[model samples]
Target: MSVAEPRRIVLFRHAKADWPQVTDHERPLAERGRKDAAVAGRRLAGTGVPFDLALCSTATRTRETWKLAVHELPQRPKTVYEERVYEASPGELIAVLNETPDDVRNLILVGHNPGIQGLAEVLSGSAEGDARERMTRRGFPAAAFALVSFEGSWKTLEPGVATLLDYWAPSE
Candidate 1:
């Protein structure tokens, strides 16, 4: 894609996790999470974004979430299980995104919050229609995702550069 072409980032928070005896990183998705994840995937497919890549956290819940969600998409994007995304802060998440290959025009990030939520808020300089309001009001709940778009190279992705195009939560 040309540098001037718009790039889209989907910030997706992992689904709710079960309280297993395993480590936090090993905890799997809850029953509700399983159902919600598929629903999220269907909704994402509905957007017709044609995602090129998925940057997913390495945590078990996040991995599980992606597995279920991707099944609902028309085509699966290349996935990278990134450890840096696990428990990362908003700035840290942005740093990870900055490393994304310029060839990727549409990217989906499956991780945890408040980093996902924080990233959504930090990068969104503005929003379309009621997107910002809905995102703020609904909050970034589990299985929630926000779509943001910007025009620039991945290296230039920074605070306040993107526009919040849409937001979705399983509940809504």
Candidate 2:
């Protein structure tokens, strides 16, 4: 797709994690998280966005979430396990995204909040319909995702540059 064509970024927060004896980075997902991750995956597939790449945090929970979620996609995109996404702030996440090659028109980032939620709020200048309201009301819970659309190269991404097109969370 050309730079003129719109690009999409899916900001996905990892599902609930279990408080294990391991370090925070090594904690695994809870049973509920496993199920929710799969459901979120199916929901994402329903959106019909053919993702070109996935940038996943190297944390165990995020990795597991992506593993289950990607299974439901029609076709799995190329995935990169990046340590930088572990506890990155919104600005840091933007830096990582800015490095994305232009060929990736649709991309997903599987990570933890408040970075994920912060990124959504930072990037979305406006929203379509009740997307922003719903996102705020629902509170970027486990297994939730916000889909933002913008134009231009990934390097051009910045605050107020994208529109929050949709938000989804598993029904409690």
Candidate 3:
């Protein structure tokens, strides 16, 4: 039997956002956020993980985060802006994953916290070292990302089915 290509899911929480914006969705990334995003991008580029698609939240912060992160990527991946991911719950995020087309193997999700953090927590089957410890301690902080590998298709993904490959948070 031919080996199945591992479905990699990269969960990226938008970098730190400034509070000056009038609305939550209108908020922009802070100075530190830009720096952190660039660093995160460089790190991602080093991994040589070529993403096939990215589903991002419509919020300004999320949009900005994706924009900056992709700058360091070797190749720009196809991106879709979905309003539903703006503040999606864990279940909602799972639904989004389930709806992904089978053709898209490598995926990236750039969104907000609580929801993103919640999704990462529930889906992470196993992790090791300081990364796991940091996740448990601080949860998903701004500019933090969790890389997971799933053996099954996106449609079949469920809690504890994927392994957390890496968790990273860029410092200011």
Q: Which residue segments of model 1 deviate by more than 4 Å?
A: none
Better of 1 and 3 by lDDT: 1
Model with the higher TM-score, candidate 1 or 3: 1
lDDT (Cα, tens digit) per residue for candidate 2, span 1-172:
7998999999999998999899999999999999999999999999999999999999999999999999999999999999999999999999999999999999999999999999999999999999999999999999999999999999999999999999999999
Clashes of each: 0, 0, 0
lDDT of 3 by residue, 1-172 (tens): 1126788889999999999947999999999998888888888887778899999999999999899999999999999999999889988999999998888888899999899988888898787556677777767889999888887667888888888888888753
Weakest lDDT window of 10 consecutive positions for candidate 2: 1-10
Against the true structure, candidate 3 reaches a TM-score of 0.94
**Model 1 misses residue 149 by how many Å?**
0.1
Error of 1 at 4 (Å): 0.3
RMSD of 3: 1.8
The lowest-lDDT stretch of 10 consecutive residues in candidate 3 is 1-10
Which of the predicted structures, 2 or 3, would earn the higher lDDT when compared with the native?
A: 2
Top candidate on TM-score is 2
Scored against the true structure, residue 165 in model 2 reaches a CA lDDT of: 97
Among all windows of 10 consecutive residues in model 1, the one with the lowest summed lDDT is 163-172
